[model samples]
Target: MKFTRRLFLGLAALLLGVGATMAHAANALDTIKQRKKILVAVDIGGPPYGMIDEQARQVGSDVEAARLLAQDLGVTLQIVPVSGPNRVPFLLSRKADVVMASFSITEDRKKVIDFSEPYGVVPVVIGGPASAKVASFADLSGKTIAVTRGTTSDQELTRGSKGIPSVSIVRYEDDATTNTAVATGQQDYIAAPPSTILAVKKASPSRDIASKFAMKAYPYGIGVRKNEPELKAWLDGWVKTNLKNGKLDEIYKRYFGMSLPPEVLQ
Candidate 1:
């Protein structure tokens, strides 16, 4: 009888220990609320999404969205500049509470970080002068195309040009360089992101530069650490609420000069 009683007591103690561990497990929501600030990682080089403004400040649509998110949470927003390759790493290392660096949702990326539902969309399109004879991807059989190295636009255009003969590709380090190549006729066309391309087109209103065709589109999402279910749920709902309420649209239009595209809504 004494042995049985001791065993029961040990079992109770084990259960209590398990309960304590569960209760004390780290939770991003609790921590964020307690700290009163959410550190958002962003890249200042990704134009329209994140970039330097005329005042030489790191500002972009993504930065503004982060601001709105902080406002919704009634917390302070702390911006941490990160490069494309390091955004995910920053989140995993707890260097940032969230990442809003135009992080595009992809199947491969899902294996690493949790993405909030898409907050914005940017299309990858081939743009050029309207006077250019190119009508389709096939039409660019032997023509030169400009793209930033390591972008979806570069990957897709390169993949599509596999069998096409004499399809020259010029890879630049940045979107501005690609745009300049097109503007100077050093490149016949530029396969680039929607926002940067739009800004370029707007800059040269009489040049007839326009989106010739789409290569791909990406719905950008806010990123958080994996296993933070509460944080993920809250972030997703926050994005959905703002998007549905037209608040996200207002921010987009304020930066990019148009409402969110219908494709983005889908």
Candidate 2:
């Protein structure tokens, strides 16, 4: 049997393509195996999700979740405290292997990072003084709205509240500052995630603030590099396992003071 030169070249090219794909896959696996550590980016300012405690230790739902994930994978978890603005950049730069912050999955962010199956949902809320006449989003017109910088609350108030006129937006360095500003009348209202708002209210019973409005629910998930499909799949599998065995609910209640909502559990 005589092989034509053209056919020989085609076979060579095909073999090279397959070899390259295999090499790429192997390299990715090697990267994970060799390090034996998963770098997790978490917010140090968002309590009940990810935050730094008085002792300077990372502590919160996302932090605990990341620790469990690392334990399950038999790897060391290196927590890298990150601000909201830098979460995506850290993942892109390989400074972190995953983001376990309370990052709301958005179409815009999907362009930069891959999100695992949503592990929980956070409802948005508008908080203000109990004496305020504000009743809804419509009441926010011509009002000063305080929000943590680089958060989904900031994005939503800036983009979603288009119907409101003269809405002055105030950006704070962290959730605590944002909530405090509203409570102290430095801002008219604070747009924040419901869990954080509730936590703050609990911590400061004298604040006399009321969560007067609730908005669309935002799903929260872990983030990985956009190209790391395998890592994303593994994270989803872990979430499923935890949710099925009731561990997920336990974790939620421990941090948020409530069980996983039906929508999220289902």
Candidate 3:
């Protein structure tokens, strides 16, 4: 019965996808021009990618990227705070024009939404206080590690621990809290990107937290509804121009303290 139900749902989804694609001739560029604003979904709970700054303003790499995209489009920017569960939903419901929420370009997600060329890259890894002794994923055998709920870190960590019964993955509501658990010794380590670990270091500068082993990396892309060819083309072009002109490099240096690596400039 479970297998039958699963098959039914999969078939339904496939049909819906076909229908959406067949009906995808709508002009996203026209709608944006008429609205005069681009509604961007951003995950602000993760520092460096998105966060509330000292001035109580929303700031981060993703946020700044959205701002630049809007600027180039000659439109106002409207930010909508979104989490993993809501990112695609809000975008599909028309509450968001695009998502710049540090969303990774993945094959699974590509089934639902089209992604622009990658604008950034995140090196995924396990890091903790130097004393944790996590040298690799297998080294985490019985370690207590934290990961943000519903994030790529969480998904990857869960999938990687299929046979490691002693591995305890502690899930947190937000990336900040997940990293905090490691910094404060509540957990042995955290599955996070190097950039996130760097942000954690800024708060606890005295702590000696270093990378253990890297998992698959994430490439940041702008998400658009699957059928929005015009919007997708424009976003890809925008990325190309910014990469050539160095606006993205400026954004990266402001927060990460250095220019973005050549590999991520796509």
Candidate 4:
């Protein structure tokens, strides 16, 4: 009886030790350490966020941010091209470690993934031909507006101008299509972030109809899996530190041609 009891106690102690070690090893940060690589999802179609450069290298604000984050984490950064609609699904499926796409935070999105603290703010604007008379958001009523289907600009126009009768929304699969639609006069106006619209206009100066509407500011954030609190905290700290140290401002100017607005710089 005594021998049996001693053996049972020994086995219980061994299991308890193993359980404690497993619990510690299962920590989010530790899991990342074990993997030694962070897979970042970036949109290949979105410029100024994530897109392929002439050299076929991924280049954009999100891509740069991921590279910096991975460097800070002492892990290799793996870029995964993801579409706007597949962002959350890819993260939830463990196909990516983080999403550095220019994702706007929304209540509906919060249900599936967690967003890092806001690192950038983009204003939705209505752009038309320079000769076109679109001075304000209300002016778009009864007009054909082009926008990317799954973007915040679309959501904003849908919610902000729902009361304006005759405002027809034309959805495009990507920004390039939306720009083409507006440039060709197939769409009367294009609703998008000022930075992106401005870039498009610069790329095609002949697209005489280019303007932006004044709307609420849309903050952009990095995304991670819902339960990855440690990673979230790390990313938030990384952004805060970079912003305070002026690195973030430099990045903003490199991509957007100017420093971030004071509100966003903070």
Two-way lDDT contest, 3 vs 4, winner: 3
Writing each residue's lDDT as its tens digit, candidate 4 over 135-246 gives 7667777788888887788888888787887889989877777767766668767788776676667667777656555766777788878777777888888888888888
Question: lDDT of each model, Cα atoms only?
Answer: 0.82, 0.80, 0.84, 0.80
Tell me the tens digit of each residue's lDDT in model 1 across 1-266.
99999999999999999998786567888889999998999877777888887898878899899999999999999999876556777899999999997777877778988899888876788887787677677878878888877666777788777888888998887666777777766776788776766767766666567888787778888888888899899998898899889889898998878888776555
Root-mean-square deviation of every model: 3.8, 3.3, 9.3, 3.1
Stretches of candidate 4 off by over 4 Å are 1-26
Model 2 segments more than 4 A misplaced:
1-30, 173-180, 183-185, 199-206
TM per prediction: 0.78, 0.86, 0.84, 0.85
Best first by TM-score, ranked: 2, 4, 3, 1
Give the TM-score comparing model 1 with the true structure, all chains together.
Answer: 0.78
Clashing pairs in 2: none
114-162 per-residue lDDT for model 2 (tens digits): 8988887777778776787887677888788888887788887777678
Model 1 residue pairs with clashes: none
Q: List the residue pairs that clash in candidate 4.
A: 125-213, 126-212, 126-213, 127-211, 128-209, 128-210, 128-211, 129-209, 129-210
Where's the lowest-lDDT run of ten residues in candidate 3? 21-30
The digit string of per-residue lDDT tens for model 3 on 1-266 reads 99999999999999999888766536788788888998999989777889998899999988898999999999999999987657888999989989998898888889999999888877678888767667667887877888888778888888887798699988887776787887777875888888778777777777777777888888889999987889999999998899889998898788777877777773
What's the CA error at residue 19 for candidate 4, in Å?
7.3
